[model samples]
Target: MRFVQVAQHADDLKRAAAFYAALFDVEPAALFDPPGLLFFDVGGVRLLLEKGAPSSLLYFEVADLHGTVAALRSRGVKIVQDPQLIYTHDDNTLGPSNSEEWMAFIEDSESNTVGLVSHTLAAGD
Candidate 1:
């Protein structure tokens, strides 16, 4: 079955909401306080930010890894690891053939490590 929702810890909902909104470039789909829950529709998956949920390391695919990292850095977002080529997809098993997979890590507002990924055409491809 496909993922319906993913939960992430957020001590302060407002702070987390603002951070996520900037990163995702979209407003949250829903918020339910009192019980303290906020949700964002991430590619049809519900990203639930909750007060009691444990922190999760989430990975998101972006069209431009470097550009996204730069924009985030300019906004004082902590870059845990700079973007770098992670792997070359020689075959179509994990990704498109003759493509390069790049990845970078950053710290979310709540201090959870988040991974950003991108795939680009390999040299001479």
Candidate 2:
């Protein structure tokens, strides 16, 4: 099976939508005012933000790691960690068999954790 959508809890939908739109450079596909829910399009993925708790953790993969991080920072997004390289192995491969990628995390106004990831495979494997 494939992953379809992820729903995140937000204290305020409008604030959350504006924060995400500024960070991702895309407007929400739709917003339900009474329910306070916002839907965002991330390629084929759909992110649903609904009013609930104050904090949550969400992850999104992007192509431009540095640019995205910078843009998010410029928009007043709180940076939890600067972009850094991380390596992992699919299996317990021996010597120099690990793959690497870049990733970063940020906190929304409500202190929710949002991760930005850039994979090596999509950059041409």
Candidate 3:
């Protein structure tokens, strides 16, 4: 099955929209003014933000680790964890191998945990 959309509750739609726009470096494709629902295109995935209960965590895979982190920081988004390297071992040889993946967590005004991830593994790796 293919993934379609993920939704997060926002306390303030405008503020949350701005936060996400800055974090992802793209504006929302649509916004429902009366209902306070905003939609953003994240690569091939769709993210929907509306006024409701806050979410615990939402993970997003991004292309540019440094640029995404910088944008989030500039917008005053709280960083729960900074980007760091993680080591993985080869399954067959048990040899040490390194992969560059970065993770960061942030809470919106409504206390939704937004996680940013950058996976460095190749298609077949």
The 10 consecutive residues of candidate 2 with the worst lDDT sum are: 89-98
Model 1 poorest 10 in a row by lDDT: 28-37
TM-score of each: 0.97, 0.76, 0.73
Q: Give each model's clash number.
A: 0, 0, 0
User: How large is the C-alpha RMSD of every model relative to the true structure?
Assistant: 0.8, 4.4, 4.8
1-125 per-residue lDDT for model 3 (tens digits): 98888888887888888877876778898998887778999877788888764574787777776677787778777767777654344442422243445677767766777777775653356
lDDT winner, 1 or 3 = 1
Looking at model 3, which ten-residue stretch has the lowest summed lDDT?
Answer: 87-96
Please report how far candidate 2 places residue 72 from its true position, in Å.
Answer: 2.1
The number of the candidate with the highest TM-score is 1
Question: Local distance difference test, per candidate?
Answer: 0.96, 0.76, 0.73
lDDT of 1 by residue, 1-125 (tens): 89899999999999999999999999999999888999999999999999899999999999999999999999999999999999999999998899999999999999999999999999888
lDDT of 3 at 61: 75
Q: Which residues of candidate 3, in runs, are more than 4 Å off?
A: 53-56, 86-98, 121-125
